[model samples]
Target: MNFFTIKTSWSNAEFILIKLCMASAYILIGSCFHDFFENHYSVLIGVFIITAIWFVYQWLKKMKSHSDIPY
Candidate 1:
């Protein structure tokens, strides 16, 4: 109801949206690389590293969300 409360709720919503975007991005990127790496194991390893980095970033962002913020 107050300004800070409203701001926090909005920020939480944004965080959720960002998490979704990250997940979709990883899925799409990984699948594309997987398909393209059929004959190249080295490329597949690179893709895995990139995807792992993305996952870590997303996890950190999600952890930043305030649990007290009202959805």
Candidate 2:
């Protein structure tokens, strides 16, 4: 049940599914409010950039952890 540790296939699948759903929701909402986004394009771009960086950081961290395993 740990956030960072996906020990089972089912848990891993669920985690991926949830992440995808959240990402999709973000995109869908942004597109749905295209006019509002156009008015605040800079802010929206900044938020997306930050989110992308954070996602990359987490991916790298996960990769590093897995690489450290003895298997």
Candidate 3:
């Protein structure tokens, strides 16, 4: 691993898992407002869980690889 080049000690499976996590984070963040638009408490809560799960799954993927969820 270097500034110009990248290398990961994690297995391919781990990398995929991390990417999935990051993606989910984004989805949750998007869904967060769905409740407001439709007025569904379940949607709001569901989004919250997704957001939280994605927040933690962030560690699954390499931070430097990509910002799966926008800052």
TM-score of every model versus the real structure = 0.38, 0.50, 0.35
In model 1, the clashing pairs are none
Summing lDDT over every window of 10 consecutive residues in candidate 3, give the lowest-scoring window: 1-10
Mind sharing the TM-score for model 2? 0.50
Error of 1 at 44 (Å): 0.7
Q: lDDT per prediction?
A: 0.56, 0.57, 0.55
- Residues 1-71, candidate 3: write the lDDT tens digits: 24455433566765564465565556556756665444554554565566556545654455546534443
Highest lDDT, which number?
A: 2
What would the C-alpha RMSD of candidate 2 be, to one decimal place?
7.7
When sorted by lDDT, best at the front, the candidate numbers are: 2, 1, 3
TM-score of 1: 0.38
Residue 38 miss distance in model 2 (angstroms):
1.5
Which residue ranges in model 2 land beyond 4 Å of their true spot? 1-33
For residues 1-71, what per-residue lDDT tens digits would candidate 2 score against the true structure?
Answer: 35566432234643553465466558647766676555655555556666666656666666667665554
Best by TM-score: 2
TM-score of candidate 3 versus the correct structure, residues matched by position: 0.35
